[model samples]
Structure formats: structure tokens, C-alpha cells
Target: MADEIKNTENQELDWDSPISKDAGEFEIPPIGEYTFTVANLEKTMSKSGNKMADLTISLDVNGQAYVRHDYLVLTSNMAWKLASFFECIGLKEKGQELTHMPWDKVPGARGRCKIIHEDYNGRPTVRIDRYLPLTGSAPAQATAATAPANDMPFEV
Candidate 1:
């Protein structure tokens, strides 16, 4: 025997009451590096039917909550972001490939990320500039010790 869920009546919302507009307003934090934790990872399909990983990073600045969304497409061209994400979380090395890596373990990972504010269509939006591994982590040590001799220009 199984228990059945009971349907309840829907309550009406009071639209005529005065609402505080300031309660919903939030100011974007300054563009700089900040510590963030991976709050959630959502795997979904893109519009073109390609696999996509949506990362939700939560940041605490002066006791305020801020969130940034990063989308990683599992494609050759866009895979670097995924790699960077792993490196940021101290999970992968530079120039290393982990095709069979377990992505289910990404939540709760902590790192620092550079954030930039950009104006999109007259609205201010926060964008993740780059991700950096936390100090004393393996990936951070590797990045510091084995930095490329020549500064190569690349975009992520």
C-alpha cells in the first residue's frame, strides 16, 4: 500500500497591498577576486541538444549573498571553461584531460574567482572573469611552479 498526496486549495495572493520595492533591489559587488563555493551543478541539454553543465557559485561579501552562473558546454571549443573549473576546484591539472571524470562530486567545492561587471543592454550584470584555486591547494602550487615560460594569450 502507498500513501497518496492530497491536493489542497490554492490561496490567493494580495496584490493590492503595498510592497516594498527596496527589498528586492540588490547592488552588484565591486569587480575583484572573491572566495566562492560551488552551491550546485545542474546538468542539462543545450538548445542544440549538446550537453551543458551549469554551475552556480555562491559568494558571501560583507554578509550579503551573491550568485554567479557559469555555463560549460562539453565541446572541444568550450571545454577549457570546464577544465578551468576543475583546476579552480583543485581537481585537475593544466593540459590534462579527464574525459571520464566524475562530475557529480563538484558541489561544495571552494575556490576564488575573478568577477567583472559588464553592462548588457543597459543593465548591469556580473560575469566570472576567471577561476583560481585556493592557496595551499595542489592546483595552485602546480600553477605557481610550472607557469609557462612564455606568456601565451588565450581566452576562456
Candidate 2:
């Protein structure tokens, strides 16, 4: 099994990739060049054709699978959620003008941020300080800041 967030040691997760961003006080993760890869769409196979309970995805960076969750998403909803994030922040989509591309190995979200993962008191949080890219102008110099309304580190 892969190491959990709390158990993993901090290392040079993004050392080789060259990063680029505007030369102003841009937001933290909203700016910066990072390398990322999305997991290919997969079907949970079982002899019993019962509906799946959740979707499992393996998010990676240069073949390094950093995060994995079972049964959280598996249909168009998850794909749309991730795609909308890419569209919202003005990141490059895999297939331009082709609309509604499949969600396999697409250029997944990239940007290092002090991520706060939840809204309630029991929400999880994390800070990704790597080649995380930010959208918008350079004035958004990234730093420790509170998550915006209706989002707790949903910037992915």
C-alpha cells in the first residue's frame, strides 16, 4: 500500500520539472510550472456485475502515484468535476475544440498550494509546495491563505 499523507516524508517531489509563471505577486499555487499525469479511466472488474460503490483513481506525477482513493468517483460526474476545475483556472485542456474528451491520462491539475481539504471542523488539510501552477495574473503571489467561499482546497 502507498503511504498515507500523514505518514509520507517530505522530499523533492518535483525536482526535475522546469516551472514558469508570471513575474508578479501571483497567487501561490495559481502560478508555477508543474508536471502531472492523470490516471487512465478504468473499470472495476468483478464476476458479479453489481454496481460499483465508489470510483477509484490513482493520481500521479512522473509515474509517482501520490494519491489513491477507492470508489470515490467512476462516471461522468467525477470527470466533469475535474474538467471544470481545469476550465475554471484556465489551464490547458488535453483536447481543445474536441469537447468532452475522455478522462484517461489527461494533463491533470498542477499547482502547489497550502491545501485545506475540508470545510467543517473535521475536514482534512495539506500544503503542497512543489511545481503547482496557478491561474490568473501575477499579483496572486501564493502563500498561506484561507480557502475561498464554498471551497476548501478544491482548487485542484
Candidate 3:
């Protein structure tokens, strides 16, 4: 089922809300003017609920910020819409080497769209960081060589 999304990169959005108007034709941003991209999307549905997904989107655009953590968490369908938008922005799928981020999730009936805000400088900037993942290096190797294996009995 997910393959449908993983296949082709080109796709259209139903865009059922008014909020998308400002985003639809967003300029690609001048070469060095600014760099924006949806970084990661995460969704979790209550095991007992009627398929309601709680979502948190992280972004890595411009400097760094998360406009909204609870941006909108409704249903799987809506979640994909937000995910697709990010994909189109080149942030979700920039490349495999530099960074790897998850997808954002949204609810079915996300109310009228509006710009999410985050405190950046003295101004209220959008929280694009919500779509990004925390970046850090792997742990270092132990100072000693290969240590002795555990004696506990536990077959593979």
C-alpha cells in the first residue's frame, strides 16, 4: 500500500482547504535567498481510537525552527497530503547521503489553513523545524578491543 507513495515522485494534491492557497505557488526561492524543505513527518494513531493520528512535523528550512508540532493531526488521508507537499518541496527527498527524515501526518478534516508561527528573532516565523529530525553523530567505539561474550544462555 505504501509503495504507491514510494514509487513516483510526481503527484497532485486534492487541496481541500483554503490554507493551501498561499503555499500552492510558493516561489522556489531565489538561489541563495532562502532554502526551505520539509524534513520529517511522524504520526501515531491511538490503538483504541477511531483511526485518529497524532502528528508532529519537523522541518529544516532557512535557519531552523518548528512552526507547529500539533500542526494538524486528523486522518491518514490528510497526513499523506501534507507528506506529498513536503516531497514536492524537495526537503523530504533531497537525497540519500546528506540526511534522512520521516514524513509528517495530518488529520482528515484539518480546519481552514493558516500560517503556523514560531518565535524567531523578534519576529514570529513559521516553525519549519517541525519537519526535521535531530542530527547527531554515532557513538564512538569502546576503548578496549573485542570484549568477552556474555555467558548467559540465549540461542539465536
Best-fitting candidate, measured by lDDT?
1
> Candidate 1: TM-score?
0.69
How many pairs collide in each candidate, listed in order? 0, 22, 22
Candidate 2, residues 46-142: lDDT per residue as tens digits?
Answer: 3454333222223333344444333323355556444443443345343544354433423242332222232234433222322233455321212
State which candidate, 1 or 3, has the greater lDDT.
1
TM-score of each: 0.69, 0.28, 0.24
After superposition on all C-alphas, the RMSD of every candidate to the true structure, in Å, is 16.8, 17.9, 19.1
Error of 1 at 69 (Å): 1.4
**On residues 31-129, what C-alpha lDDT tens digit does candidate 3 reach at each position?**
221223223334556565543433332322343432234333455556554454344333344233314233332221112122344445554444322
* lDDT of model 1 at position 72: 81
Candidate 3 ranges with C-alpha deviation above 4 Å: 1-40, 46-55, 59-62, 70-156
* Model 1: how far residue 15 lies from native, Å: 12
- What is the alpha-carbon RMSD of candidate 1 to the true structure? 16.8
Q: What lDDT does model 1 reach?
A: 0.70
Runs off by more than 4 Å, candidate 1: 1-18, 21-24, 138-156
